[model samples]
Target: MNKRLYLELENCIGCRSCLAACTQCGGHDERNRNYVYDVNPLVNTQTMPLMCLHCVNPACARSCPAQAIQIHETGAVLSALVEKCIGCQNCTIACPYGIPKFDTEQNLMYKCDLCIDRSKDGIPPMCASVCPTNTLQWLTDEEIERKQKQFNVKNDKWVTSIHLENETNVRVNLPGILQGITKLY
Candidate 1:
């Protein structure tokens, strides 16, 4: 649990490797839980990976009337339990980053579970392991600190679009253009 997930927006090359790897995760039902987005499709090819930020007090979990979404001991906000899920779609609407997805046919809510099956044992998540550009990284606190210092980044925390109820577990280093902005588009 000492290792944390980290993202460097500038390092991503839009390869989609992380997305491909996500489908192979256990309990994922061959569906990719992560996403890659074009930073600005018209202007540049720079792409960024988007997944659950695993917020400290997740809105998704809070809004679930069935209380299906649970937070793991390792601080990962897990996807909804099939039996507990009520298909209310509250999680999809509550999340600030739009991370959760609802399967209409299956009547379920699914999001990034941070590969708990592997990460609980200190192994890197599948996305981080397959990222050839090192954009998605799994690192210890010490390594994260080193990278922050090396990049001259004052704060490693960032959010996409809007502020969440609290901070997220995952750390992100914004691209140079958005360095001080602290908001990811």
Candidate 2:
């Protein structure tokens, strides 16, 4: 049940395919609603994609006095019960990544579900599926570790960190050449 999403910033080609896919899957109006942030650090040529890290101790979950946020068993998925949300904006302020978006029309908060709906059909997430350079990857923790080790063997840098908040877990890292590239973004 230990799953994670991996981002290879160096491999990223600044494509917005993942962003488009995420918005489309979330809902019809989500296209302009969802976004993939592109940051190019002054020293780095590669672009870094910023999104929800789905922290184990999710600040958003704890901040949500309404208890609208929940993490699935796999630990990679975070969901917001729109019906339960009170539109307090606590989750938005609590989230360090600022991933949760406030829906002005619906008066609710929305963020990435990691495409849980698409997973029901045994499909990879929109971002991963459309990545031409294979920059974004989703895998179980064990699988991620194996790949990390392989990268280490090749003298690649594997920076890993974990944080827990509000009964949610967040694991993040940059691998290989992407490590330095991501920092620039």
Cα lDDT of model 2 by residue, 1-185, tens digit: 44456676666667777777776774435643335455655755456566666676678887888888987665544556877988899989987777888877888887777676654444666676777776677666687678767656332234333322333333345654453333232
TM-score of each: 0.90, 0.76
What is the TM-score of candidate 1?
Answer: 0.90
User: How high is the CA lDDT of each candidate model?
Assistant: 0.86, 0.63
Best by lDDT: 1
RMSD of each: 3.6, 4.4
Q: List the residue pairs that clash in candidate 1.
A: none
| Candidate 1 wrong stretches, greater than 4 Å | 156-162, 178-185
lDDT string for model 1 (1-91, tens) is 5888888877788999999999999989999999999989999787889999888889999999999999999999999999999999999
Clashes of each: 0, 13
